[model samples]
Structures are given as C-alpha cells and as structure tokens.
Target chain A: MIKARVTVTLKNGVLDPQGKAIEGALGSLGFEDVGQVRQGKVFDLELDSADPGTAKQQITAMCEKLLANTVIEDYAVELL
Target chain B: MIKARVTVTLKNGVLDPQGKAIEGALGSLGFEDVGQVRQGKVFDLELDSADPGTAKQQITAMCEKLLANTVIEDYAVELL
Candidate 1:
C-alpha cells in the first residue's frame, strides 16, 4: 500500500473567519502577540494499492473533485 | 511584523477519529482505495513584533502552552 498526505489552504486575500476566531482564542490564551492567523486543512491517506504513480493520480483526482475547494484553496501532496 | 506557520499533528499510533470520518466521506466520494486517514491543523500567524528570534520563541511558547495539546499533538513552525 502507499500513503499520501494532502493539505488544502486558502489563497492569499481570501477571508478566513475560522482562523480569525482562533486568533482571538489564542489571545485569550495569552498569545497577545499573535497579530493574524489563517487556517488550513490536512488529510493523510493510506491507499489500498501500492503503485505510487497510480495512487498519486487517484488522490489528486480526489482532491480536485471532492477533498478540496479548488476555487478558494490550493493543495499540496506528499507521498509516504 | 513577522509571520509563522505552525502545524500541529497527532503523533503516530494515536487514533484520529476525525480523519477516519473524513476517510469515510472520501469513500463515499468514490475514493474506494483510501485505506486510512489522519488529519492535522495549520495556523498561519502574523506576529506583533518583527524580530525573528522573539517571534519564534513566542510562537513556540504558545504552541507548547495552549495552541497545541502537547500530550497528543506535535508541532512545527515555519517563519514567513
């Protein structure tokens, strides 16, 4: 089997309310120096098949079609 | 001001229920080959002060103290 880790993150200039809320939460936790925050998502996937090339292609398709919001976010993948 | 991106992830061997749920979602989305999944958190922070040394120390302290549940997750920070 093969493993892949994919991360999806909003593009610069996009508003990130979740990240802003967390930033506020951090300040309450005493991280007063934290000026701004943006958040991203991560997915670590283990594949049933072992072929790296095929697994990557399938995973990329998954990200494009379902796992990620391509209009708002960009994705990166790592194989393990 | 300076910026840092901190990613916090569950340690290997820890159960990731959220990732599992997402894995199930992926299967429903037609990713039948996905065998397992794990997830991580990302924080992109802009610091109040510009000094690299101070910003790094503060962010590290925050991660250790509250931003991450250290007992369950490990964290890494990148300067920006």
Candidate 2:
C-alpha cells in the first residue's frame, strides 16, 4: 500500500485564530524566543495500490474532496 | 543557520470542530470515501547555526514559545 501524507493550511488571506492562540500559549510555555506560528493538518492515507499515478489521483481527490478547503486553505501531498 | 520544521496538532481529547467541519465539507465536495479528518500545523524556521544539538534546543524552545499549544495541542519537530 502507498502512504499518502497530506497537509492543509489556511490561506494567507484567512484569519487563523487557533494559530494565534497557539502562538500565545507557546510564549507562556517558556518558549519566550518564538515569534510566530502557523498551523495546519497532516493526514496519512494507506492505499492499496502503490502506483504513483493512481495514488496521486486518489490523494489529490482526497485533498480536493475533504483534506483541504480550497476556499480558505491550500493543500500539498507527499507519498511514502 | 539551521532549519527547523515544526508541527502542531490538537490533542485527541480536544474538540477539533474545524477538522470536523472540514470532514463534512469534503463529503459535500464529492469525496464520499473519506472517513475521518484531523487538522494541525507546520512551521519552517531558518536558524543561525546547523548544529543538531543546538538546533534542537532552539527549535524546542520555538515550539514551547510559539509553536504548539501545550494546552490543546502536541508538537514534534524535525530538521531539514
């Protein structure tokens, strides 16, 4: 099986309060040196076929269909 | 300089409504096969040194200071 790793991130134009909140939390946690933080997600999909073409198609479909918000987020996929 | 890659994820106990919302959105987007969706973040930091030990200390500080929400998120880092 192919393992597909997907990451979805908020678009630059979108507001990320969660990220902001985390940034605040980190500062309180003794990481006084941290300046900024961006947040997103990672998805690991185990597929049946190892074919790159088919996997890419399936993974892209997964991202477009559910992994990423094309409206507010951007997505990229990596295969392993 | 060293490079650090950081990822922040909501703790399993926390409510990831954003992730849930994304899951529902994906279903509406025609990816009927996706089952569950979880969201997180990634950070790429350019550091002043390439040493692994120092880089790790710096990166960990970055995480504690600004990367992960120790309250609702867990974080891990990698060098790149």
Candidate 3:
C-alpha cells in the first residue's frame, strides 16, 4: 500500500477568516512574534497500490473530485 | 523569518467521523482501493525568528497550548 498526504491550502488571494482568528488568539496568548498565519487541511490516505505512479494519479484524481475546493484552494500531494 | 507547518491528527483509536465520511464519499466517487482516511488540520505559520531551534521550540509550545488537543490528538511540526 502507498501512504499519501494531501495538503489543501488557500490560494494566494483567498481570504481566510479562521487563520485570522488564530493569529489574533496567538497574539493574545503571548506569542507576539507570529506573522501571517494560514490554516489548511491535511488528509492522510492509505491506498491499496504498490506503484507510486499509479497511487499519485489516483490521489490527485481524488483531490480534484472531492478532496479540494479548486475554486479558492490549492492542494499538494506527497507520497510517504 | 522562519516558516513552519504544524499538522494535527487524531491519535490511534480516536473516533474520526469526518474521516469516515470522506472515506465513504471517496468510495462512492469510484476510488474503491482506499483504506483508512484520516482528516487533519494544518497551520502554515511565519515567525519572526531566523534560528531554527528557537522557531521549533516556539512552534511546539504553540501546539501544546493551542493548536492541538493533547488528550486525543497529536501534532507534528516541520520547518520549511
């Protein structure tokens, strides 16, 4: 089996209110040196494929079909 | 400045209904060879520190204090 990680992050111009909230909270909690904070989603997937090439293709298809919102978010897949 | 990524994932045996839902959704979408699917949170942070050691330490502390639910979730920090 091939283990894959998909990280979905907001695109450069997308607004992220959750990230802003976290940044504000961090500052309140005394972590003052923090700069821009962006929050994203991570998916750890186990695929029943031995070939890395096939697995990556399948995972990328999965991302396009369901994992990521392509309108405002970008996704990166890594095989582990 | 140092850039960091913090990933928070449910620990072993922790119930992940969101993951289960995604798995089911994937199966319905025709990606049938999938095994376990775990959903997680990722934070991309920028800290005003040039030193990796101090940045890592600060990030870990942030995880312990806010980013992760220590009782049921674990977090891993990566400097990038």
Best by the lDDT measure? 3
Best by TM-score: 3
* Candidates ranked by lDDT: 3, 1, 2
- Per-residue error at B54 for model 2, in Å? 0.4
Best prediction by DockQ? 3
* lDDT of model 3 at position A74: 99
Tens digit per residue, CA lDDT, model 1, A1-80: 89788988898889999988888888998878888788998787899997898998998998898778999999988897
Scanning candidate 1 chain B in windows of ten residues, the lowest lDDT window is B41-50
TM-score of each: 0.82, 0.65, 0.98
DockQ of 3: 0.92
**TM-score, candidate number 1:** 0.82
Model 3 Cα lDDT, one tens digit per residue, B1-80? 99999999999999999999999999999999999999999999999998999999999999999999999999999999
Q: Model 2: runs farther than 4 Å from truth? A: A1-4, A8-56, A64-74
**lDDT (Cα) of model 1:** 0.87
For model 2, the chain A TM-score is: 0.91
